[model samples]
Target: MNTVPWLTILLIVPAAGAVVVAALPRRHATLAKQLTLAITLAVLVLAVLATFAYDPDKAGFQFGQSYDWISTFGISYSVGADGISLVLMLLAALLVPVVVLSSWDEVDGGGAGGGRIPAPTATPDATGGTPGGSAGGPGPAGDVGEIGAAGEIGGVGGVGGIGGVGGGSGGTAVALAAPAPAPARPATVPPVETRGEAETHGRRSVPAFFALLLALEAGMIGVFAATDVFLFYVFFEAMLIPMYFLIGSYGPVTEQAQRSYAAVKFLVYSLLGGLLMLAAVIGLYVVSADNLGHGTFDFATLRQMEITPGVQKLLFLGFFVAFAIKAPLFPFHTWLPDAGAQSPTGGAVLLVGVLDKVGTFGLIRYCIPLFPDAADYFAPMVLGLAVVGIFYGALLAIGQRDMKRLVAYTSLAHFGFIALGLFAFTSQAGTGAVLYMVNHGLSTGLLFLVVGFLVTRRGTRDVGAYGGLAKVTPVLAGVFLIAGLSSLALPGTNSFVSEFLVLVGTFTANKPLAIVATCGIVLAAVYVLYLYQRTMTGPVVHEENRVLHDLGLREKIVVAPMVALIVALGVYPKPLLDIIRPTVTATYADIGKSDPAPTHPAAAHPGAAHPGAAHPGAAHPGATHPVATQPGGHS
Candidate 1:
């Protein structure tokens, strides 16, 4: 029964719910919330069951389902999950429901920080005397003062299930990296704000946007599950529409500078990457036809086709570029922080939690398997870049004033770790990278949701403005502590287990890189502790902060599950590792057999002319060369 094409149902039900949600009467807020929550919850339940039912020992796609879609091109409405896709899909299904619930009170405008799109022009009855209505700007003078107060009476709400997990050392290190906030310079909003019109159109076109979100999900799921290259391209290209609306229309504080800039930047980068990938995909299909006697976009077929080393190197660039931008790796990563900081909390959650994983996923699924030699060839450069991202993102995060943007840069660091684990060429690293993707989604998504609440109440994203908040909102403080700690890879938390695996695996392959990566763990503590200290510690200085409140039932319920998983996965990672290990082992075996050993300078010098040329048998003119074998080893 579990094998009955569950992926299709997982993709379709939310889509159907979007339709149901739009048709309901505008006044029926309760029904809308209930309907959306129920649909997302159902998806979660199914996805969970699918995860359990999945056979990790299996070497190929399972719960496989296919139906002809574009017969002429051999495209099919097909879906399946291997260990990699299983974890990612589970990540998506788990978070969407939580995000929905977190927004229940806000969208309904019935609880703390209540605000929704097409914000009521006049103060509504449900706002409970909160001033400034629902544009979600600062409320009365009291609300403004509360923003400045830190250690006042417990006015903020508790984060129920998501708080109280351990691993504080790891998480704290990341948070304490800096004390000051980035200077706030006013943004230049074009007088016309053409983006504003698009947003208005999107709000009026809620049904359309919702449909697009579902469609995006469908494409993302397909991209992960696809066994065929052309099918992957089709789904990959389809993702842009929903994301465009999610950024352009449903963004938080749509009138702000970040929103418009993020939306446009995201579109340009994603589209450019897609076009380059499209050319590569077409080229691969043509090559397969000529070489293998069939024009096929199937992943299995392409993997078996033996293209020249030159072809692999060139083609790898096209695919790698696309995936890196999606992964938003270091240099290509400029657009992500902006999109994450300004977009709706839900959009940000999905973008970081689920979508970003696609890039790394592509690395494992397509890059390594199809271009093994190229991947081996490029390993050093990739590892170097990953290291840079880890440090650069942490430094940037430490300097952030906006809490949302802070969360965004931290994710960049996290992605760097995941990428390092992946290209490090150890099975342990690969499994860790896969599991990290799941843990990141759960933890980061929760962080964004919680921060959204903060923004909702305070009308600002500035960290310095908040002082000793633990006294006012111990529950929120606890929630932030857990989420921040998890981000920092605290022990007894899910992130710790995966991060440990990555470090352990990376160290096994490259000790110096591992040592450098460990510095990121320290940086993690610095930024995370700073975030916690600035927001939740100290005395409540502002007079207005004296009356602020803490977490209510709705917020508690939404946060609890995510926090629970952080603990569960942290303590009992064996279950997840057990599943991921087998698949990773199989993939690495395939890749390793085809590619030569990656040669770092240390391996190449054996007491050579310089430390950079540490290995004796370096190959290729590219900077630290990769060698097929040790100079002393038998052929």
Candidate 2:
């Protein structure tokens, strides 16, 4: 079944895992978690195979499977993977397993983190992960939280219960107890986790927690994989439910009011956006029916319809506002900070890393392609707002004391950059924007995981509470620094390449805007380095931080893939770029734009006698706009 419908299986596997986890008893919470993790990792395997199996040289929508769901209305269970969707699907699949492993101790509390191990100051604490595949012992990262300490603060969570479980009315549901022992470690190494010290710890609703996480994973994959316009909308709105529950029921209970408010705010904003899109959907159907004698919501079919610029503009706004809310651009970004504060770390990782991408993805996949005129009309306005968001988000992030909220705001900045690359409409810019999505997911997800570790160990997400952390938890400090560098688009990191392409692309389109946006990069470095300096570099004045342990084996495993990708993509990004270029070329064709030629300093002046004779105004003379290919053949 190599030729089987892999995209459908990619969707169904996590869904099946969620159902299985839901069916299991709370007493089997450990087993349910293990099973769910295995299924997610297995999906990762599938994604890797799909990537290799794909013939990157020739691209369109590969692995396409369309079937009639509503024959009368022209909607169907249509799904496919192109270079663009494939990378995102891989991102969604990759993160679930890492989040599972990183939060393993928090959820199950199988052992005391630092009670059995020597502190980093006393001796090297190698109780956890090595650099790569192994979640080796918390090697020099430090001896973090002591046994029986409160882990990540719960707006809706508690030390005594896993799911804050309630005994069921029908007979009696099984109550979750202790975390099961992890798989046996090599005998040469000392037992870093002292289970006896952590026997009283861990959450009680393990089965329920895994079920919710798996459900969210499934929704994310479906959103990226759906090809039909109607199917895409269904997945778009459906992904929000698990997130709502995760925030409302899984955060620190002390901040229950804040968590509840955040959840409600998120729900209200998302619902408002969804309703607008729903109205636009009906309008599209009606318009298509009048023009083509049948109602249709096929993305390809709608692209071919000769809708008037007026109608296209109206439909575009409905979709754009929804996407903008999802993107959480400057004026629309107020809801994100609250939600980030209240969400569980894993939930936050998925929220900022993957779910937010759906908005930008919608812009690339639907809004622009289907409404080229509207997209062109709005390009200047959108680009203007995007530049505003970049500066606005950076300034706010620099001023924030809360770690989670700071990370959330940075995402706003990154999304603004992605939006800029897209509206510039150059192939280089488009390719870079798509690559930015994948790289941003890796770097930001790592930052959240590290912050989660700090919050759980210290009972605070406030930056003011931390000082001289690098002296205590060196490895964590290092990880945080790397993430910061990536955030600020430091040279030799994944983000720099994408950001460079965006600047180059924007310059050809709008010189003044490009110059303005470039200043945002300077602001990015300011916030990133300032946050690091305040938290990790000062004297270790706090008594509680002195004993903090470095990364454990489990935590190392969580970061290895992310670290590898950051460097891997930085050095050679061809694999992902190859996958992204074909679809980007197609997008350009849909919008009627040409790849602007590269300009060199010597050849840039209009009167200069150079081979390219490059003019700042248009495509190079006598040369075809290489729409479906890269400059040097493969980026």
Candidate 3:
């Protein structure tokens, strides 16, 4: 009944901003970037205000607004925020601005006056020569013994000269031989002046990139705030367009073909999942019609429907598969590595840090609450898959060479933990799962941003490419270590609290699985420390690494808040837990489940008075009088 339409405004601001930014002249690229950052910041402020307005004591969705959109079909334009949705909305808003700041230099042509700046190439060594050369001249050329070899000589050595023996006059021999053959330009390549235009011709414009980012922000907010099932689906699919372009056209990879392949793979997997979910959505509508005498896609109404277990199982598979694919759990996780590795840094932050969370959110929001019976039936199988993903992702992460892919795999493992908590059917576990989602976004987002900073300097993702980076970029190394430690759920970090809660809750229900999952913690430490040791420690072997600069002003600005939050939340989690716990309890209550009670061996003895038992005649352990429950009093 809230009249402000807070969720709608949240959706419109960014969506409207995307259109305006996209329509700007190409020369206004800097304006576009600045404007996009401002808009995201505004959204963050609004999200915070909304959180302040939300009442944790409330039992239902807040800031809710609804209107019948398709009366005949029972669909509505509805939106609201619950505790889970509010936190996630805040998370998405928080990261988008950080991503923009981190990507200031990564996006091509974001310079002043919106002019196209050429992408950073390998740094020239001292004496004004490429890294390939030892001295100031061109790299050493291939030896030519005969006239035929001379033709090959022209193409052998790098810029400066062909068959250059050293820094001496020999470096210029190839240049004088044949004028360097005009560098043998590709037939399809455009002239230098027009190359930027060509790259931006179809879908690679700088304005488009910023526009897509804003649009993506809108979509992410919409997904979390939406209350109508069909409306959720719309936002779910709409976000993919921007992500596709972000991955394919604007990725950091130099090879357009590789970016395109990764983009296509991501698109294909998502579309398949979407198709399955679409069928399930329609199935829900049909089932609703059969029961209620009309079809409806209203989530609240749908949750109230009494679904038969058999049909619930069918619908559950459809939704579960789609969400699992989104979660990219184990077998369906192949697309993520390529996509994450190929995406632009800002895009990657949103990809793993926010977008991938939709799957787990859907499981909590729709799969469990709407189909509680089916969820209970399938909990065991899902838990097994989650456990498998934990180890599978951890093992793969330990073996990855690409830093981006390694981070992506770590997310897969973390998702397993989130999934396990959700299925554990306890309030503590569910609350921890929700908290885990937020912490993962903060910690992993920091990890991705830091990696992007490193890649910006080193120009490579290979772990072996770096050694003793801490020697030169000590601040950067320090930040990277903190991020890695957080990822491994180190004590006194935010992840450790949520992770601990998950294990403790799971142990109460399923001891063996909880114990097995504990091993993933060790594996997390192994991969995280191994990554840190390989990249930041040891002797500085590469000369390029020696010159690497530490984090600059902007980079520090990007990381400061994240680090503060990670540490702050680790120390005092009571605020977030207070907000999240009530919803988790309500959700379990709706499912007709309660926390499992603990038992002691003494309870098995006959005629034994339990110390904590309430009875009319039971004597207090230390008090002078016997304790008793009043008549008609509830336990």
List all candidate RMSDs to the true structure.
13.1, 10.2, 9.9
Candidate 1 per-residue lDDT over residues 199-236, each given as its tens digit: 12111233443444455566666677776677787778
Local accuracy by lDDT, each model: 0.69, 0.75, 0.77
TM-score of every candidate relative to the true structure: 0.79, 0.83, 0.82
Task: Please give the distance, in angstroms, between residue 267's alpha carbon in candidate 3 and its true position after superposition.
Answer: 0.6
Q: Give model 2's clash tally.
A: 41
Ranking of models by lDDT:
3, 2, 1
Q: Which regions in candidate 2 have their CA more than 4 angstroms from the true location? A: 108-204, 597-625, 629-635
* Tens-digit lDDT track of model 3 for 1-635: 24567788889999999999999986677798799999999999988888887777677788888899988888888898888888999999999989887766556423211223233233432333322221111122232211111111122233443432212223332233542412322333323221221112121356788899999999999999988999999898898999998998777423456778999999999999999999999999999999999999988888889999999999999999988988778778999999998888889999988999999999989999889999999999999999999999999999998888999999999999999999998766787889999999999989988887776666567888889988888988999988998999998889988898788768767999999999999999999999999999999988867776788888889899999999988888877776776677677777776666536555334444753222334332110112111211000
Task: Give one digit per residue, the lDDT tens place, for model 2 in 1-635.
Answer: 33768889998999999988989986786698689889999999998888887765554567778899998999999887777888999999999998776655555544313322121121111233211111212101111221222212111123332321112222122223443222223344322111121221243356777788899898988988887888989999998888998787665543557878999999999999999998888889999999999998877677778999999999999999999999887678889999987887788888888988888888888888878899999999999889999999999999998888999999989989999989999876787788888889988888888787776555467787788999998988998898889989998888887887778777777889999999999999998998899889989977877877787777777888898888878777777877887788777865677766555675556665543344433332111225754211111
* Backbone steric clashes in candidate 1, count: 49
- The lDDT, on a scale of 0 to 1, for candidate 1 is 0.69
